[model samples]
Target: MIHCMTSFAQSERSALCDTFLEVGPDAPTLSGSWRTRDLAAHLILRERRPDAAIGMFLAPLAGRTDKIQASLAQRPFEELVDTIRSGPPKWNPMALGSIDEAANLGEFFVHHEDVLRGVDPAARRQLDPAEQKALFGVLSRMGMLTLRSCRVGVVADSPGYGRRSLRSPKDEHGNVVMTGEPSEIVLYLFGRGEVADVELDGADHDVAAFRETNLGV
Candidate 1:
């Protein structure tokens, strides 16, 4: 399981990095208040902070926004990518232990889409099924489907599986119905790109707002 999860994360990291490389320096920033550049810096900062990783499972909601801001002055994108490729400063077995493997998978999966959406949409098709399943399971747990508080929803069109809502925020109205291949839905929910190609529906204003609000620690 550990090996599988590691491979999954690496694949996602590669895709995200490639997408970032494709994004021109002047690419339009994401529509939300926060830009994609901020998200990229945040991920790199997280990988370097040992304390954050150790406490991430228990305090996943803590310090993320601050960490991103604090690391804004980090080295250029090229240097950051090289550091990430080198791996986390010190891998914590406990951190992975606190969260289910599926949850960890979801983290990388969603974040990968987040980065890709802000940068390059064309590369999104590269993600694999194992990665999508991991993200789908996590989004469901986060309640993204019911259009409640979740920002994304998954509509299962396959036989034997009734349509189910995944993640959204509470007090939210309307829905982002993600239909088509499960992989596409997973990528879209993670913020990879627009879901116009899928059978999804929802108010763009709400999603843009949710994306703007900082949810990380």
Candidate 2:
């Protein structure tokens, strides 16, 4: 059931892979205290190994996932990075078209940002117009699921990119509106709101509730 590859997503993935090699394995990432080596191992395991990938999202399998990732991390840095740059193996679902595009675009894009943001919050890449559209397209379809934890309705407005509600039926605190560029919205959706250059409008309590709730996976 793998879908078509999104051109923007694939391009971003390729760029992320290249950057990983350039920065070296020990470089720090926005993933808490994880470095590039940990991120590289994560990509390999998530894409190439079904067991490991499953464990990543399932609490019961998380320990197993960690062990496999640690083992992969122990490999020679150059070798591990090269595998990521080469992309997933052909037999892997991630090697398929749209599935890779939809699944990896955010993973790579966010992780790519994680690397840069970890070093400097001001260091931001200029995304292409099409890339922005692609991101919003993906968000439009998945925003609800990503923001399911919100007790209040959350409306996102990104101008040319269109708008969508991450939640519906205003909660006790009512609805909150988030305004920003699509890219900024994407970052906020992925749990980077504190530093994300987005504006919130609504009651303080409602806004806080929206911000505090888990926004994405």
Candidate 3:
């Protein structure tokens, strides 16, 4: 059961590594101005260089993080992908199976989609039921933080998984309801809304306000 729960992260990592190779280093990705090379470097550093990884979430350290990432990006693209394929080094906490599952499952899933959608704007992947459920569980646990920037209440409505109140409606104008599969919702919440296949239903102004807000961590 433990292996079953953790396997998706490993699969996603493997698939993402394959994608990095297929797309080569110059391919574009949904992440800001980063290409495949930059994204690959970011992933490697995030796992191997804990000293610099904190900058990903800490604004004050972001400059240092950027510097390290840029340096890593200079390495051969195939080499970077190979490192990612090899998984975290033993010294990293993510080398532990459970830790990798918890930290990288959604990270790799979303990033894999980022590359796919970046290459082809119309790209979409059909996730298995277990994958959907696992992603939805992450949303249920982290939705509030991911959607906190929105001024109105946000609700995620995944048909089979049921609804999660991502954020309480901040005003009486009503909630901005997002309907999609768990995987799509994950992509949307993680700053890939432009390519995510989710549908939004809400008052026009509320929707506008929600759209204007920056989302995801």
For each candidate in turn, give its C-alpha RMSD to the true structure in angstroms.
6.5, 3.2, 1.8
**Which residue runs does candidate 1 get wrong by more than 4 Å?**
1-3, 22-36, 50-70, 91-104, 120-126, 144-155, 158-178, 187-197, 200-217
For residues 8-69, write the lDDT of model 3, one tens digit per residue: 89999999999999999999999999999999999998999999999989999999999999
- Displacement of residue 128 (Cα, Å) in model 1 is 3.2
Score every model by TM-score: 0.56, 0.91, 0.93
Q: What residue runs in model 3 are displaced by over 4 Å at the alpha carbon?
A: 1-3, 171-173
- Lowest-scoring 10 consecutive residues by lDDT in candidate 1? 153-162
How do the residues 57-154 of candidate 2 rate in per-residue lDDT, one tens digit apiece?
79999999999999999898888877887787998877777787877777778888887787677887888777777777767556765786668777
Q: Per-residue lDDT tens digits of candidate 1, residues 61-178?
A: 4576456444663457676555555545446442453343543455555665555554555544554555555544554654433234344433443222335655433454544555
The order of the candidates by lDDT, greatest first, is: 3, 2, 1
Error of 2 at 73 (Å): 1.1
Number of the top TM-score candidate: 3
**How many residue pairs clash per model?**
22, 5, 0
